[model samples]
Target: MASQLNSGSDLGFEADLFKAADKLRGNLEPSEYKHVALGLIFLKYISEAFSAHYKKLGEEEYADQEDPEEYLAANVFWVPPEARWEHLQANAKRPQINFTDVNTGKERVGDIGNLIDNAMDSIERANAAVLKDVLPKEYGRPQLDKTMLGELIDLFSKVGMHSADGKSKDLLGRAYEYFISQFAGAEGRRGGEFFTPRSVVQTIVEMLEPHHGRVYDPACGSGGMFVQSERFIENHQGRRSDIAIYGQERNHTTWKLCKMNLAVRGIDADIKWNNEGSFLSDAFPTLKFDYAMANPPFNISDWWQPQLEGDVRWKYGQPPAGNANFAWLQHIIHHLAPRGTAGVVLANGSMSSQQSGEGDIRKAMIEGDVVDCMVALPGQLFYSTQIPACLWFLARDKSANGHRDRRGEILFIDARNLGHMVDRTRREFSTSDIATIANIYHCWRAKPDAGLGAYQDIPGFCKSATLEEVRKHGHVLTPGRYVGAEDAEDDGVPFAERFAALTATLEDQFNESDRLTALIREKLSMVRYDV
Candidate 1:
């Protein structure tokens, strides 16, 4: 898969550019440095894009002087000379004046922070909506060192980030994503609210197989889910234009990140921003999506449940004002079309929580036959919270596959033991790990009457539990309790001999415990005398 990616020598290769830039981060926080590095990358991308069109205008073949419409017609933003990359790189080493005319006279540039602010303003004026109020304007603070800022600019300039050809490459896009991931790692608990791990997003896309139509993310964070979905279609030999993406993000800063993220990937998505969130003011109220994917904030407390307590969208049961787990579930469920399927990540509590009517809501949804599968994911799979997470797959119509009209059965998979550690602190499923999980789901969901592969109750893995069986288990969807333990070993040795061996093992353990206690006391005495 890595080999299939765009394989070129990667011109202007400065692999350690970000590392060098980091060295200049004297007292600046990564949260602050994030905007600085990403802002420059955004500027570089726009400049390269502008230069590409500017050259064609200069050439005789495409010469159309005095016609800005020529460039606008091709979806290119018009950039002024001062905001262009060449001009910035030329003056990168030189100090420049900076001022804001807020009912006052022009002021001199006393710091690099002020210079960066003016640069962002110049870019915004050149191409209005392209960057309007998007750039982080807090960098001109006293905390950010002037020498460090200069060094970062020089480091970024060394790369061919300003060239027209660089626009065609996703080097900047990849770099931006890389930096976001690094920031997520740095800022552990708060990171999950903004970024979704690429592997988790890929798993959802792989399972849903969103070939075409609208893809939606209700709690889209930095737009990773939608971006991965587009890549999924492209990887499957489908045109990127085959899918239209839609999303809604509650946080304004995250919404801005989502916009920038989608723009960097060259994927057009109509992402909406509102502080009220999807529960209160659903931006896509009337919209039904063919595919839905999200990692909604886990166990969201204070989700304005009182305002939406009697809302019509709650078809299953009213989610408690204390927790929005079931509310997010029904919202995604309501958005699915007749044949639509959705993959959502939620807290482990949602799988079996009976607290505050959550269990009843889950039971109602189960009896209605929308829940297709539930996977218990390993802990530490998220950056935001350490709590265990699970993946929920919901389908609108199970009869489409002719699987005995399976409106009563739900597949439960316990994959808490599946992923491997990518680092000491985080775990991510590999491509094979993803395929293993997706293939299992596809296998179990195959039509029983269609003569395809049949589903089975694997003792240590998956089990297709019926509605009656689910009721017998009191609707607790934990897979381990249902799948049960594997068969006991049957050796040729007699049961009497085995019992004798077990008794001897127990006796040995008791004797060994006594010897270890004496060794501990000797070490304690030596340490006490030395003290």
Candidate 2:
């Protein structure tokens, strides 16, 4: 645990706080230290929320501040006396804590780590129904650095989380989200296991616009889809309670992170976790959601099993044993209501893959008129792999859901050129970019641009292609194949004159290069060698 001090950045939003925390991480790996930092942040968040509620309860003559139900009724976790942030901060620097056992008439000794662990335990015990075993309690391990841990606790205590910028910016939630991304950046592909980039998630949420319905994510990562959906609703002045959240995550650690991430934002979602995962052990087997949005692991080859050969979820066809791309598509399709719609993020290969019946499955979906729209995402947008990805928009009943009847036509947007580089290695969709893409999809769904409206397909950018056209191409949905070349601006210059001028310039450049080389050799020959 001495290495807990050795743990782990600077992002723009909460870069200063993260920089301070990184300095304190001494040598701890980002993966391990993230739990430590996040666990403390969760502890502090719930403690502070409870403290504020407890203060108000103290003024009520008949109120019993110790009553757990009082906090539970207000949607606040009941932090036990010893588990409070104030109590933890008071003992942060202590070398040892002495506890007198009243029942056993004995004394107990523990360092700050033990105290912190006990605090998490007590809090979990008090809120078992909601937060059972979600908090990390490994700080008590002797291998962790006590001094560094104390400094972290002290550091967090000095900072204001709720209203840092003289505004209710949900800075605590921002910090948690920011830390998840920072840790994801540090962990590389492993981090992608627990997170989807915010802009990518937002793009899906804004396009799908999961307004007032049951939203499901089979590969929900850290609940980013749900969070963004809720944010979208709020941003549009929609009621939060109008929507319900359901998700399933296979990895236990990522599930815990998702739980904490949602908790920080005060979102109540039914997120399930099983080692067998969404594919093998369908979590919401009998449930159909109105909206299903997800970013599944791209092109996983080892997810196939003999038991899935006859699985009912594979309605279109049995997915190949080597790739689960079609399996995920079918699973999401299986879970949609008659009028349900889904937006899925997959490897770009899904758009044009011809391997192992993936092409046949795509063709079947196309013929069934379920494929609605596809958008090609820009490269380098993910922290995980550089495999370019695309979005698959499907609707169960596209013609009858108050949408324009165009069952045979699928819209394709070539957005591989969208988004700007945020740093040297990463690119992100700006707000304008998200809005533009979302608007295009919305306009197309509302009505086809008869060359006079908002949805006109620009050459090499977007197109609404017919089923017959797709059939001619063997169901390869890569936008580039359909969108055509982007229209180029013209600077009128005659072919012969321009060719002659360009040739003369090239000849002159070649002659200048030869002259410079000969001149350099002559000068070297004239120079005197001393040794």
Candidate 3:
């Protein structure tokens, strides 16, 4: 991991690179361009790994050990002869000639376009499961002009991107991830299709505190949850190696992105891919996870729920087929270990919607003492939808952490007003904001505080509500309704004096407006006389 994030400040490297690539975007949208950029990064990564192994083979000490096995032993995919970075760079200036290459046939090797397809085919054969659908072989399509292909290759070559050191710096990885976020932001609602806000991931990590355990994401998008879990371990002075990661992604392209993202961070994760999501396939049927987190698509309607009518995971109640919110909840509940805790993001309706037997599921979970904490998140936190989101913390046992018995009580945090806008359209919780929310949960869950902030509850901020109180509210989990309105300031001024001062200011403003009107009239009369 690079100690300093080059994407943060004065380093215009990523910005410049993205701008140049965007120029070449031409007729392709950001979503399509994402595949193009990620493929290049993956190509660069494998090529560098191959080059590194090849250099070692050239050394006399390891000359006998220089085989594909040597590279595979180190988790490096074998880059075939024609797919090497040097070979591609040599022909970057001319991306149209059908030069001969022994491996890819006497086909076009001079064109950067053909090289991309050849590389994709080679990688697909090398690692079928991980890279089969990840590489961009369609660059040779009629849409991409030869001149533009050459320009892109030239730009990438100039960035010192061909070397192992450059790829290993983790710079390219961050840049590529940054591009994902940028595209997500650019695409608006569709952005949520593949990306989750980083701050939300951090907040979940901070609260769940997945120090050492199996971390899983059922609807893993680009593996942000897994990456954040690794980051949490490192931040807590714990080794990421102590934790195991497992994930399942329905989208093939997104799954590839997740694999590449994890690979870039050097994190080993077992990611399963299938058209049917966890709902239909149930990848890890018998395995229980220590910590599970996910940001599932909000209000998913076409989840193929009819096929899973009597699923065993529905311990609470059968979720409404029209909405998959409760279904995802039950899935995580079923997958949790005896000592497991999970934090998930869902559409705000899950908190209070009583439609279609959802209220029954909520009541059952509450009665079972599984629902831990509920948080109301602010709007615009996601790129995919403007609908508000909330967080649900589910714990197998409240007594696991030696905290007070919170079975009868649930922590409701009204953080709907928290977070700052990152841009005009999207808002993300800052580091302090994340810490503040996490600290509140930690302090409340501690042996003593469990749900108090400082001394008194900040109005409209947070509150600890008992099961009876929750029942009084009819199982609705919206925090604002329970937390009440925020506190108002006491100016300490007398009512009469304050009223007089306000009246005087209004009178002065009125007099000034009248004088301006008279001056305008005099100016008009003078103009008429002159005419």
- Best of the candidates, lDDT: 2
Which candidate order results from sorting by lDDT in descending order? 2, 3, 1
Residue 145, candidate 2: how far off, in angstroms?
Answer: 0.9
RMSD values, in order shown:
8.8, 9.7, 10.1
Error of 3 at 156 (Å): 2.5
lDDT, candidate 1, residue 413?
81
> lDDT tens string, model 3, 119-142?
777767766745656666777777
128, model 2: CA deviation in Å?
Answer: 1.4
Q: Whole-model lDDT for model 1 versus the true structure? A: 0.75
lDDT of 1 by residue, 1-531 (tens): 122122334532333555666777777777777777777767666666667777777886757743657766766666655456665565555655444422243666545556566667776665556567666666567766666666666666555533345444456666677667777787777766889888888888888889998999999989889888877877789988899999999999888788877776667788888899999899999999989999999887888645786888799988888888888989999998777889999877787778898889988888888999887777777778778778899999987633446678888887767888978889998889888778777778776555646667777778888889888867766665566732111221233678889999999998898788888888887874434
Clashes of 3: 5
TM-score of each: 0.82, 0.86, 0.83
* Residues 1-531 of candidate 2: C-alpha lDDT, one tens digit per residue: 222211221124366667788899888999999999999988888888888879889999999999999998988889888789998899989998975332244677888888888888788778787688788889989889999889988878765555423234256777788888889888898887778999999999988888898999998888889988988988899988999999999989889888888887778899999999998999899999999999999888899877887899888889998889999999999999999999999887787778898889999999999999999888888999888788999999988576678688999998878899988988999999998888888888874544425678888789999999999978888887789943111121323567788899999999999999999999999999788
In lDDT terms, how accurate is model 2? 0.84
Cα lDDT for residue 182, model 2? 86
> Which has the greatest TM-score?
2
Clashes of each: 0, 11, 5
